[model samples]
Target: MKALDYTILTLVIIGAINWGLIGFLQFDLVRVLFGDMSILSRIVYALIGISGLYAISYFGRIGKAME
Candidate 1:
């Protein structure tokens, strides 16, 4: 479970950095490395999206900590 959390967090961070690069420099590291909308790239995108959604659970943890 800890490993899964770490993996998801890593993916989310990667997605965030990629978005930052795109916003700042108009660069897409994922598309450049994986091919624009290729199967692999799509998979990476999907995984990142899922990770982002799953990350919502992290807020629940934060709320608990505030108590």
Candidate 2:
């Protein structure tokens, strides 16, 4: 569970960075690496979305840990 949390967190961070790049520089690292509209790029985007959803539970875990 701990490793899973870390992995999801890392993915979320990567997604955040990608969004930052898109917002500020008009660049998408995933599309650049995988090709525009490629299946691989789509998978990467989906995984990032899933990771973001998983990360929503992080606050609950942290609150429990702090107790």
Candidate 3:
């Protein structure tokens, strides 16, 4: 369970950094590494999307902690 959490956290961080690079430098690291619109890149994009959605739930918990 702990390992899964760490894995998800790592993926989310990677996704965030990739987005940061894209926003700042117009780079697409995943596409550049895996080929544009390739299956592997699409899978990675999907995983990152899912991770982002899952991470949103944590924001509510943080809000609760502050209250």
Candidate 4:
């Protein structure tokens, strides 16, 4: 994978893990790490969300890759 693809995947995985923590342990890792709704935390949240949206493009390539 290219660097951009890898980065996006990494962010998505991190986001998933963060969500898991929130669901299972009632923890907010990003908030704990970067303060509640602080600018840095907000930026991290935005990047994770954008990465998730970009990940949708992967579905389009699945068929092409299988060919």
Candidate 5:
């Protein structure tokens, strides 16, 4: 995969893990690291959202690669 795809996937994975922690343990990695609603945490959230959208495009790429 290309660099952009890799970056997005990494961000998405991180976000997913954070969400899992939050849901299962009542903890948030981003908030703990950056303070609630801090600039850094906000940026991470934005990147996570964008990464999720970018990941959707990879669905087609994977389909093609599998053929």
Candidate 6:
């Protein structure tokens, strides 16, 4: 579980950095590396999305842990 959490968190951070690059510089690292709208790129995007959703549960878990 700890490994899973760390993995998801890392993915989420990567996603955030990618978004930041896209917003500020109009650059897309994933698209650049994988080609625009390619299957591989789509898979990466989906994983990032899933990770983001999984991260939503972290707040609750942290709250409970802090109690």
lDDT of 3 by residue, 10-64 (tens): 8899999999999999999998999998999999999988887877777886799
lDDT of 4 by residue, 1-67 (tens): 6899999999999999999999999999999999999999999999999999999999988878998
TM-score of 2: 0.94
Clashes of each: 0, 0, 0, 0, 0, 0
Query: Which pairs in model 1 have colliding backbones?
Result: none
How many clashes show up in model 2?
A: 0
Between candidates 3 and 4, which one is better according to lDDT?
4
**CA lDDT of 67 in candidate 5?**
100
Worst 10 residues of 2 by lDDT: 53-62
Model 3 error, position 5 (Å): 1.2
Local accuracy of candidate 1 as per-residue lDDT tens digits, 1-67 = 7899899999999999999999999999999999999999999999999999998999998899899
State the lDDT of candidate 2 residue by residue for 1-67, as single tens digits: 8899889999999999999999999999998999997999999999999999989898898899999
What digit string (tens of lDDT, one per residue) describes model 6 on residues 1-67? 9999999999999999999999999999999999998999999999999999999999999999999
Model 6 misses residue 26 by how many Å?
A: 0.4
Candidate 2 positional error at 25, Å: 0.5
The candidate, 1 or 3, that scores higher on lDDT is 1
Tell me the alpha-carbon RMSD of every candidate.
1.0, 0.8, 2.1, 1.0, 1.1, 0.5
Candidate ordering by TM-score (highest first)? 6, 4, 2, 1, 5, 3
Q: Write the per-residue lDDT of candidate 5 for residues 1-67, one digit (tens) a residue.
A: 5998889999999999999999999999999998899898899999999999989999898899999
Whose lDDT is higher: candidate 4's or candidate 5's?
Answer: 4
Considering every candidate listed, which one attains the maximal TM-score?
6
Question: Which is the winner by TM-score between candidate 2 and candidate 3?
Answer: 2
Which residues of candidate 4, in runs, are more than 4 Å off? none
TM-score head-to-head 3 vs 5, winner: 5
